[model samples]
Target chain A: MRSQSEPTQSAGKRAAPPYEQIKLFLKERLENGHWTPGALMPSEADLVAKFAVSRMTVNRALRELQLEGLVDRVQGVGTFAAQLHRVSSSLTIRDIHEEVLERGHVHHATVHLAKAESASATAAQRLGVGLNASVFHTVIVHYENGVALQCEDRYVNPECAPDYLSVDFTKITPTHYLLDVAPLWEARFAVEAGLPTAREAKLLGLKITDPVLIVSRRTVNRGVPITQARLVHPAGRYQIDGVFKP
Target chain B: MRSQSEPTQSAGKRAAPPYEQIKLFLKERLENGHWTPGALMPSEADLVAKFAVSRMTVNRALRELQLEGLVDRVQGVGTFAAQLHRVSSSLTIRDIHEEVLERGHVHHATVHLAKAESASATAAQRLGVGLNASVFHTVIVHYENGVALQCEDRYVNPECAPDYLSVDFTKITPTHYLLDVAPLWEARFAVEAGLPTAREAKLLGLKITDPVLIVSRRTVNRGVPITQARLVHPAGRYQIDGVFKP
Candidate 1:
């Protein structure tokens, strides 16, 4: 996408302040992973020349990003994009499909298991249901570029999503369906490193020795437990990385 | 949430196995934060006497707890409760000591390595310093109740925190020390899963087979890189978990 920064400097009637426009332009590239973490950003002189703005305006934009933890600047040294990979400073629980697609990549799911099962001890406690109660189960392997990215083992509260079993998970992810059926009010997440179980290793095409990042999340809606999901990703390929402003 | 009061009402002969009874008794104390993380647990002999069971039964009970990462059993030292801290939200970068103390537990640190080192390729790039530049390096093992929870391998920009190597890490955390010298501007964080290196495994007293949760953090101040830290925790023993509201 073309940066809107160049024309804004010449357009006197533009509503956005010069520094705000510069911030927007820089933020877009950073968010798109274009600059990447530790990559040097444009020098203030370069930005001033390109945007046709004073050094002060360019400095303000860089200063704001530095304050927001998106960029790091050093005296007599160039500014660099702060570490951005594997970061998840965004406070939203987004679907894997959306995350992949947002990066201009294809995201597909291979549903291996989708059925209702009697809640095991873990499922019962995580979902806050009676022991042996009916819990909707789905095991899906999400793929990016036909390579497995995540093994999503999710247990849903039947009361929250009665149609969970019937939905074609290959098209609609469990996260997407659950969001439509039960608006997530809050989330509790515990992240750890673990060896994938035998079944997970097989489905994800991973060796048992390969460590995977596991995000165990229990989501609630209106004070009621809705779903608990175990999302596992390859250690070398995926991580929760990002920076955020308070 | 099963009420176990009925079994206690009899108080004559417990239905549970001797080991199970012991487990429940210990679990109650741990959950109530009475024992606190890192606090030494009762010895096997003491447990056996209290539960009126054989040492074998108490051994079995403690072994189970150890596997679950609830307690640490040093070969020569006594068993201590594992860290159940860091339950911090996404917004804050908290000190490990503060996290432990918040749970009413004791916190301590062992400074394994603290000195100036030439920046390696990874360190130079991460800290945005020239290759072979002098960088402050430190490796510290943080404990909660005497149970090692985190192995922190940290690199600091000498320009930002000149007195990094001089401060006694056993008394003050790097996080605490850096904040005073270099006011934190912003932070970048990435959480992953991986196996620890030989040195890390040794420091944390973990086997090579054990998985570890790794949090790589880059903090900047006034647009300058302050410190980049690699924090490793035993997968089964420690995790980053919490609930947050929008």
Candidate 2:
């Protein structure tokens, strides 16, 4: 059940503090049915008495457990184990190059095009720039273990990353370079499943009937629109995984 | 920017509280570049003095703003605006029928198959049941305004919902019925993009060249494995939308 997500990894590496031990101890009891879902948990005072810990320690333990969806708390009532009817999940999207290298695979990039262009109406709106504004555009194909994995088509606001076109894209990913130049403060994303365009299919060496996953994003930093990017991936090699417990 | 994501709707619907007013006032200033990201925000005491509000109110405003990705709080230093470098996004997977209706379209369901079957090895593992145990299986095609949108293939553990196969699927969604029987306590979800199988294409009335977004989820309730469902949507008819501010 413990895959790549965040809660337990750091908690496991540290020596057990009193609060951490309390949380784990209670979580174990709750999981083993010491209290059924929605059953009232012991009051803070009762827990303080039983564990011989400070009220703040018990409170912190309960607070964290609630945050992790292990328990639920109601105002003017006692804490209780969670009893959710709706599925809740969090997804963490990681960098492709980092993910590939962690899996012991080599990552390579092929630069297709990099140059300045006048923004189209759609591109201008997405980047919050005026129409016909000078913006940098780049098309790059990323490979994992020499297999075509992702093709990125991007439009960057000259104000956000002035050197977007000058950098050799074959040497550095546009995502890494852009992030280095302007930290992401806001974004909007949409994902569509579709067959790739003819140009995309040719670049990725894909069959005509192959499916592709497309993700488009618009990013903003410090009130400045940064970039608009569309990423395409072959379906056979990519999936987004998410896990939830509540 | 305000499409479907949280943080501002309720704050707008209700009359602005003192904290809400303060939050908006500061957010407007920040978004207009009165202060760059990472610049020190006014200290709590300073805010209270300037706004003539209580310290608690000012603190609440700052806290909520931080939670909304509009600000970042640093202990022992002043609060700062968000400075995220990575794109953060959230995808909300809602029921197809509800989404269709929300679009002012009609929804129809055609049940293809519904019966009890001996669990195969993979099905047994997915449902956490014994191999060869009885499990309920169903296949349904969903339509929005006469256009096929989703094909749902589901396997339900008999123990989790004893009346699963007896229900009238045409009248009720499997998801609604399952939640009524056993509230979802845990789930794992995987999303894949691919050309649908011949059978799936037929169910969705999609062409062989059409792509599909396939979302598979394993659900559990009260520590018992409940159901595993795979939902396939025609790429052209449906898309998953997500928005993020940081």
Per-model C-alpha lDDT, please?
0.78, 0.78
* Model 2, span B111-141: residue lDDT tens: 9999999999988987788899999999999
TM-score of 2: 0.78
Residue A10, model 2: lDDT of 49
User: Stretches of candidate 1 above 4 Å error?
Assistant: A1-13, A16-93, B1-93
Candidate 2 ranges beyond 4 A from true positions: A1-15, A33-40, A69-72, A78-80, A83-87, A125-129, A222-224, B1-87, B97-108, B125-130, B183-186, B220-224
TM-score of chain B of each: 0.62, 0.84
Candidate 1 residue B32 C-alpha distance from true site, Å: 32
> Which residue pairs collide in model 2, if any?
none
- Candidate 2 — what's its lDDT? 0.78
Clashing pairs in 1: A73-B223, A86-A240, A86-A241, A87-A241, A87-A242, A88-A241, A88-A242, B38-B145
**iRMSD (Å), candidate 1:** 10.6
Cα-based lDDT at residue A207, candidate 1: 91
Q: Which TM-score does chain B of candidate 2 obtain?
A: 0.84
Which candidate tops DockQ? 2
**Model 2 per-residue lDDT tens digits across residues A1-246:** 432311233455675767777788787777556776678988988877776777877887897777566788988888987754333544545567776797799999999988999999977876778999999888899999999999888899888788778898787788778766766657777777988878889999987579998888878866678898888889988877777853
